[model samples]
Target: MPPSNRPIHARPQAMRNFRNEMRSATMSELTMPVAASPGRLDEAIAAFSRAIGPEHVHTDDATLAEFSDPYSPSSWDDYRPPVVLQPATVEEIQAIVRIANEYTVSLWTNSQGRNNAYGGSSPRMPGTVVVNLRRMNRVLEVNDELGYVVVEPGVSFNDLYAYVREHGHDVWIDVPDLGWGSVLGNTMDHGFGYTRYGDHAAAQCGMEVVLANGELLRTGLGALGAGDGWHVSKRGFGPSADGIFMQSNFGIVTKIGLWVMRRPDFYIYGFITVPQPDDIAALVEALRPLLLDGTIPNQPEVFNDFAALAEGAKKADVWPNPGRVPAEVLDGFRKKSGAGAWNLRFALYGREEIVDVNLAAVRSAIAHIPGSTVNGQKLRGDDREAIEALGQPGQVQAGVPSMSFLSVMDWVGAKKPGHVCLSSIAPLRGADVLKIRDIVRDACAEYGYDYGTGITLSPRHLTHISTLFYDAEDPVAVRSAYDFCREVIVKAREAGFAEYRAHIDFMDHVADQFDWNNHALLRFNETLKDALDPNGILAPGKSGIWPKRLRVK
Candidate 1:
């Protein structure tokens, strides 16, 4: 394939100069020999040429910049890879891994070449191979009978949706709103959707992974190859290796086996709106029974007032430009609550009877919250209206819809800003969730910055804290956001809550929260990294999960 068409828009001269300066400093650092550097990058390029032809490898500055930053409009930092290699086959991928191992260089795999906020398409570790997996994109196999699909790493949600629809299958593809993300990449990163198959992690049944040493391994029934490569029945024959590769830079996942959902007879998508900040604890208590009983089915995250309004208001080009509900519209909602702008979205499934039963239970629970009510659907409008509105600029909603202010990230403009998201995981218990939320909110206020937050509650009663959004253009605000994030993280740690997600900058700090003496998982990752990329090459500083050199911190 030819090189990617570079983005038409370029940053201002001053910003560009700064970027170039940063790149120069980075290059100088990379050039410093660590014991001994690998073979010349020219030789590495030549090796790539041999594997998939010379045209497939790219080393130019322009091309490198294109793959450097995730398209996150709120992020300012860019990670430039010394070289990029696009391979079309598993053999080629294995070959590249072999070459990287031989040269003691890093290799970063990105699917469909779009990684958005969490360093989309950018190498988590700078100077990594920056493997762009777009060329390998293919729906390798779709087993209707087995209710699973085998796809290459680069296969996207749009690809799967089209395939499934064209094949005339009743199966439903669990798609995030932005149909561009790779199926494998999203699942590996624990991305969530809004369907019965909401949890992408749960949708994954098996995977075809390229270990650090360039060996191929398959998990679950695929380990058995075990019958047709197209169908994988068992979850796992031994210890599950699929989970290990996810959120870890230990291996390059070239393919995956995902379980798709069958369309259900009943479906409901709407929000429960509330106004007061203090009512959150009561709301949490109300959600407990539904979540625990699995009546709610999938993940149901809570979005506070600011987050809810932002989601609906993002696409201001729509008919209801700033889709704000009238203050009176929410009357009788949670006991005459003023329109404070909070909405909790949820869905109920199964037979109509079961759904009705569940809805009744939901209403009963809502009754307990002082200022909450099951609201009419504001997000659901006529198709024509929705489609027409989508054509307007600044009205697009990318990826999955979340109540998180991060959903409104596109408003920031072309130059993506840099942000550090510090998320703490706490038990979904009402008291703890409220405590953390209050703590984070207060910290943000202390810094004279409004908090941009989102929350996700796990079925097992774990809550993921999200503190996102800050202006990278303003160094002061950026520093404030970073400091506030760190403060919240520190508070969470002191309160005995561990973090669930992190960026590379905060990985060391996150690890410090865990016990180094008896941390089995950390130790296990270390052993695995040694066994695989023994030279400590692949994604050297990603989340501190691997690379012995970075692990010293």
Candidate 2:
């Protein structure tokens, strides 16, 4: 049978059936390392089952495998959690943590586990249990007047978008490339989107965290009244604690307050295509001033011809022959794309008059490029057909979310389709982008892989994220893909850059790149880890920042 035609939001029927079919793995079947004895592990499982109920405690290998990283290049056995737990309330989570500490067991936490890049849903250690929070989904509040929403970890981008639309709220939320991903999870990972609020972590106001010690704490204004008036004051009195929790294992964020934008009357999509690769520098310089002066408020993402033509594009467009398309054939795609060697995609949001004024200003900014092409289109946010016409990543820019980005996976993944992403932050210089692109492409070529790369822009910096696809069914291909990612990180670090995010296996590699002042950052993180989680049981090796007992290396 062909793949399910159900929309991306729907759960596959097979998955539903698989969830119901599970049996507990006995001591004989265990493969990974576990510090506790089999009898102790069984007792801990019983304790966890008592906390959240046996129905939610999944010890079966079939169900446990589902919680492992789907795109992991290494064997899933290395990262698979022994059991899965689903806790619906903070009290339940607190109880679960207490039980973990009692048995000295590790527990991994995930919101929706849909962020496929960087080891989706899987824990850093194999002996841990996956705490899946999909059942705790709830939209606690949507403040139309203040333009913010308070949501749980289970709330997906689609769920929030649907709620706002159904209620006819005149507001929009900045969403990342993938809509099915958890809103809180994406923000916590400091994920990027494509609007003014694209810097998701910066947009977060308050948080409710469940500490490793089974203590409930709130950050920012949330500390007051257990997060009362959280929306009103994103930053509370004294030092802000919100920054510490992101991408760290100090605590599990149960709820968050996210800023939303008031729907603009005129939403304009604009693009500038420069024919020559060298022109990318000139274009970057031209837009830098606009971005600084707020002429363009949104984060501008620039793509090479490969990214422009291949993303959400049909598989047959540039396949059959592999390893980077030839220049002549690439030029054909450029012609079809109306983009030269580089394409800059951005949006203008405001009233019709303000939008009209900005379009002229925008054209003037890019007027210096000789063969550059500038185009503009009005995005009617309320018009479904018009928004659909914009297509994929563009739809995301318009604050309309979709899983169209998945098309790339379908096109690239041969018999066994999977991708591992590595990203780094760089100065917003066209020359730098050109330099990094060469480094990334050459490294990928060395591994006989396609360098599917893209550059997402902020006001002063750009993030370079590349996807290395491999056949999951083939272990050698998977190993090659992992090696390619490691090589990419090494080259980037040698050039004085750092990975913004990394896969579970390479978290240590990315952290090692921060050697300034004898790796002071890691030391500081360790100090806090010891103070907050003295038991040293919360996500030990995450981001390579381990507590005292486990930081042997």
lDDT of each: 0.61, 0.77
- Candidate 2: tens digits of C-alpha lDDT, residues 519-548: 788778888988988877777667776666
Estimate the lDDT of model 2. 0.77
lDDT of 1 by residue, 1-553 (tens): 0011111111122223444444434333322323124455656767778988889898787777678654332233335667888899889988988877666667778787665545566665444678888888788777767677788888887777677657766555666546677888888777766566677787787788888778888887777754674344536556877787877778889888887655445544535756577666677777877888888765666666544433434322322323233334334332443434445667665566777778778888788666567842222212324422432111112112222334466433325544556567777777887778777777766654445455665555555545455444554555555456656787888877877656544454465466545666666767887777787766655555556653322
What's each prediction's TM-score? 0.80, 0.90
Clashing pairs counted in every model = 12, 1
Model 1 scores worst on lDDT over the 10 consecutive residues at: 1-10
**Model 1 segments more than 4 A misplaced:** 1-39, 71-78, 228-234, 312-341, 376-407, 413-420, 465-467, 472-480, 516-518, 549-553
- Which candidate number maximizes TM-score? 2
